[model samples]
Target: MVNESSVLFEKQGHIGILTLNRPPANAYHLEMLNCFNTSLRQAINDPEINAIIVDSSSEKFFCAGADIKVFEANTTEENAKMISQARENMALIENCEKVVIAVINGHCLGGGLEIALACDIRFAAKHQYLIGLPEINLGLIPGNGGSQRLTRLIGVSNAIQMLSTGDSISAQEAYRMGLINQLFDSEELMPAAVALASKLGQGPALAIAATKKAVYGGALLPMAEALELEKRLVDTLYDTQDGQEGFRAFVEKRPAQFTGK
Candidate 1:
């Protein structure tokens, strides 16, 4: 296990586990945000880790968002710098070759929701949990990618309503809006997240990574261009060792063992 002042990084089999470890609310301070970025880079560079799961040590908060005290104390210049760093941190999560899953154990709002938005998938607990982009309530807007990402994930109408109203949604509502992939009982959340990560960890890593790249990269392109991009990615995957192994294993009537090469 690798421990930072604000986050805990550990590996379970082939899955890397990153737990947000700040106190009562798990709010992001500048130092915690920097530590989080460093921890994420460490996980990305670890060859043994195939997939990652981001969770929280807090029982009541996946993350309450930026620390109010810190925000209040910062000057305009300092706030700008912090916002830039937060965006960079989220970008790291988005661009990582390996899949990253956010396991939301409790409340997720504002910057917290933005963090989950960057992940490839999000799984949340069924009880005592709320998720939203509520920056409007603070007389500010989401400085992170919440505005863009939420609109892309759910649609502009829903995203506007959520962000403008500064209201939290229940787990069921979040799932319905496609903000979260799935929900589980509070007691079963972590185990379920681990199971899903393990399943992805054992898949053809090259193909999986390619799929992520194609989807996210193509989402903003024209339809014709997106299709072309998809074709290119698929062709690229065809040359991978795991690609050949997959076909061979199919013909041999055996499970494919992918080495991520």
Candidate 2:
């Protein structure tokens, strides 16, 4: 049975794993978006959650993207509302202080790909796993940051080809193009994703947040402005408890325990 919750939350140490739980294709229906938004915000606000890994419950499809049937049923205003909700879902990943990772084990298209694009990192299984923005097939464009983020990630030319042709690329191609950070054998995908998330969770949390802000913020800013922001961030972080612990731990040859302060 597909839980009415539409999402499943599991915490393992500092890592929060969020699985899209709508079975079969795991399509992004209105309820799914609401669940994702709520769960992501909860994870982000929880001080104990150092990172988040988004995966899927279904084995054959990470997410089949937006539920086109729902779109077809909606009026213009309703469409706008749905798009706005999806964008809010994207923001829950993008603007989060902790790391957000997408673990794609199977088909990831349209809104599914858009969600992955919003994350700081993506890892995919090597088999039939696919990734693309296929909204053009429905005579629509991606609404949830796919157009802009895809271009920023894989260049304007490739983004156009993927979106316009509605062709999904394999995990290898995505990795080669840097769309995905890593690709693993189908059997190893989840374990690898979780291992990576755990490794990231062990780092200094504030430093990770600052680094993410620096890169993501810099991507949208002028070089000079970005550099100044980074400078200020470095200065601010230098005074944090985690910063002091990091230095002290290095001198003492021990693992640093970061409080995320």
Residue 150 in candidate 2, Cα distance off native in Å? 0.8
Give the 10-residue window scoring lowest on summed lDDT in candidate 1. 125-134
Could you tell me the TM-score of candidate 2? 0.95
lDDT of 1 by residue, 1-261 (tens): 888989999989999999999988899988999989988988889988889999999999999889888989999898888888899989999998899999998899889889999999999998867898889988988988899999999998999999899999998999999988998998899999999899989998888888889989999899999999999999988878999999999999999999998
- Cα displacement (angstroms), candidate 1, residue 86, comes to 0.7
Q: What stretches of model 1 exceed 4 Å from their correct place?
A: none
The total number of steric clashes, by the backbone 3 Å criterion, in model 2 comes to 0
lDDT of prediction 1: 0.91
Please, what are the lDDT tens digits per residue for candidate 2 over residues 93-177? 8888788989998899888888889999998888866778878887888888899999998898988898889888988899888
Enumerate clash totals for all models, in the order shown.
0, 0
Worst 10 residues of 2 by lDDT: 1-10
Q: Would you list the C-alpha lDDT of every candidate in the order shown?
A: 0.91, 0.86
lDDT of 2 at 181: 93
